[model samples]
Target: MKLNIAFFGSSLVSSYWNGAATYYRGIIRALAERGHTVTFYEPDAFDRQKHRDMEDPSWARVRVYQPTEEAALAQLKEAAKADIVVKASGVGVLDEWLEQAVLEYCGDSTTIFWDVDAPATLARVKENANDPFRELIPEYDMVLTYGGGNPVIDEYTKLGAQYCQPIYNALDPSTHHPVEPDSRFSSALLGFLGNRLPDREARVKEFFFKPAQQLHDKQFLLGGSGWEDVAQTIPNLDYAGHIYTRDHNAFNCSPLAVLNINRDSMAATGFSPPTRVFEAAGAAACLIMDYWQGVEQFLEPDTEVLVARNGDEVTAHLQNLSVERAKSIGQAARARVLAEHTYSHRAEQFEQIMKAERTSRAYV
Candidate 1:
């Protein structure tokens, strides 16, 4: 069906501090390409309005609202009028109220709780027995996650969710393909682009920092917010502060090899590849990622992507990665995502699920 999709998410135009920006862009663009009309509703918060990556896109109508309960609720009323109303996790204001209130406002619309960070969201609700979102899971028409495979699905089902599925992060070749390597982002050996987070700090210390420390002779690059001091301490590593989305392709392509490190919760849960993985792969960057359970599901380990168990293994991969070897692996990774893991492929899967849900609802 050519549905009207009302998406309530964190900043669509600004990628500043919002990690979900890339995923949201790719998926929404693909959905629009498939004839679905999307009206993206984002709030003016965290100075996201001040640092937009792009203007309102042609594919999706972007609606920027004030960050107030009155403003959010007004948008919710409009969203409930659409064919599919999605209240994504982490809208940054009145999140709990939106989770439950979205359901109350729905009539014929298919209400979806789309979680961009399923592992973190799950962890939060699980820790609190009295979390309001826990009891409200079953109230949504369905639940969609930011890739957790069976583990996340089982957890949500246990908490009384009616239907659950993972929408794994995928490549958007059109948006994030290989670009001319920029001198600004050049890294001969390894580069990583992710904002530092508390839960993932210990793991980064193990997977990223220790490896840089071990390979002190090799030049390394780090991009993202909040790692300036850590990067400076490591003599070999240079910090590229807050790389914009526009520079991401160059960031991926310039580095001989780029790394993908999941947040601790995501890594522990597995099956969750962050958007950076696909973005790097889309640019045909040789990717060495920390070992996760479902690595085999997306890319073939060792061949397509080098999976490292620890800093020692990561150091080994970087040391052993010859120009020819990196290029070969990069090509393989690129081909894999393009063939089996593009946003077009994701949009089709999402369409199928919606098809089933709408069909089932008709009979009900």
Candidate 2:
């Protein structure tokens, strides 16, 4: 069946300040390729409209709307006519309002709460007992997350969700495969791509900054937004602010090894792997990631990817890095991602979930 999937998300055309753009594009495009119709509704807030890096995608219809009660209701009404109406987390602003409105307005359509930042959302709900979303969780037909494996599933189920599944970030080999390393970044021993968020600042300091301090002789390149105000006195660490998604391949290929640092909440929850992991691996970049509970389930540690607990471990990897071994690990990770983790794989899973939902509803 050709399903109509309406998505209320951050921004489909802009990755400027939105982290979910890549995930949204990959899955939606795959679904479209499979003959599904997708309509993405993004609020014209956060200056995202001004900094759109991409044109309206051919696979999905992108609609920008004003953030008003009337506008939201209109969008909700239109979306409710579709087979699936998804309200994704971090819609830039008014997330709580959107979540509640979707649950209330989605009439016969299958309502889905797609939590891109599952750890942060769970933490917020836990801290606020009276959070409106707590009661709304069970109302949605299904709860989907970008990452946070079993922990997220268990927590959502405990909170009264009938079904909670993680649509973990996966590699789109077409967009992220290996490219020739750019000379500008190839000399750097370590590369990290992350935006500076308050929740993640301390961990970044501990993992990226401290390690750079320990290994002053090695070059480290940090690429992302919101770091211009940060003082970079560390001699070996270079700040390449605000890397575009198109430049990811060059960034991944340039560094000898790429580092993946999970935010404090994500690390504490233990199953969340951000999009960077798959992107780096897809580009055949050797990945050294911080220790997380479910790291083994995704990539084998010390083989497909390296796990680091602290600055000492990170420094050790940098110092003892063998070119042949790193290359072998990168190749292995690429093979694993291409085989099991890709947008097409995710799209198939989503189709199964929808079919199963329809089957269950038919019996009822």
Candidate 3:
């Protein structure tokens, strides 16, 4: 069937300063390349001008909706026109009433609660009994996750999610390929982008900052937003706030090694790898990541990726690996991602899930 799809989220169609937005852009574009018509809906409240990160995707049509109750209701009504409607997590603008309205107005449309941040969403639902959207989990035709593996599936299913599938983050080779090495952002040990949850912030300090502080002679670079006030007291520490998505390859190219840190919940629950990991690896930058459950599924420890459990391990990896060895590891990781973790692969999985859900609904 030729599906006309509409994606609803906080910042999909729009280029928001979040990984979910990138995921949305990549996956939707891939889906469009496969011949699906996808329309994206996002709020216009955010500063769309600061979107220096990604190019205006040519594949999908984007519509920025008004950020008012009446306007949201209007969007819901418009969404009813599509064959499939996807409500992604972290639309920052959605409230209980908005979520309820999405369910109420999505008449005959296959609705998907695509939880990009499963751990965070589940935590919210657990804490609030009055959260109206909690009861609507199972109401959706299917649930799609960005990274969480089995544990996330169990949590959502326990909360009455009928069907859940892990979509997982993937690499977009066109945008993230190895570039000529540069020295501007180069470091013997470096870290790139992220700042949201305090837990992740702390992990970055533990895994990256502390190590940099300890290895006084080694250089470290930090990228991403919300770190403007982050104290840069250490001599080796360098802060590059908010690198655009388009410059990700150039930024990664400069780093002899890059650090990857997962959120505390993701690390504890396991199987969640942020897009940055693949993004860095896609650029063939050596990755030194914190120890997380299911790290092996994506890359082998010590070979494909350097695993760090503490500051000491991180320092050791940076000190021990030669540039040639680091480059080789990065190259291997990049090959793995290109082979298994690309937006095209993700879109294929998404198509399969939609097809299976449609067939099941027919029988029901």
Count clashes in each candidate, considering only residues at least 3 apart in sequence or on different chains: 0, 0, 2
lDDT of 1 by residue, 198-286 (tens): 98788888888898898888888888999977887888888889999999999999988999898888999999999999999999999
Per TM-score, the best of the predicted structures is 1
| Per-model lDDT | 0.91, 0.89, 0.81
lDDT of 2: 0.89
Clashing pairs in 2: none
Distance (Å) between predicted and true CA of 72, model 1?
A: 0.7
Off by over 4 Å in 2: none
Q: Rank the candidates by TM-score, best first.
A: 1, 2, 3
- Per-model TM-score versus the true fold: 0.98, 0.97, 0.95
Model 1: weakest 10-residue lDDT segment is 180-189
Q: Could you give candidate 2's per-residue lDDT for residues 124-228 as a string of tens digits?
A: 899999999999999999999988888899999999998999988888887889999998788888999998899888888887888888888888999988876
| Candidate 2 TM-score, true structure as reference | 0.97
Off by over 4 Å in 3: 13-16, 52-55
lDDT of 3: 0.81
Q: What local lDDT does model 1 show for residue 21?
A: 98
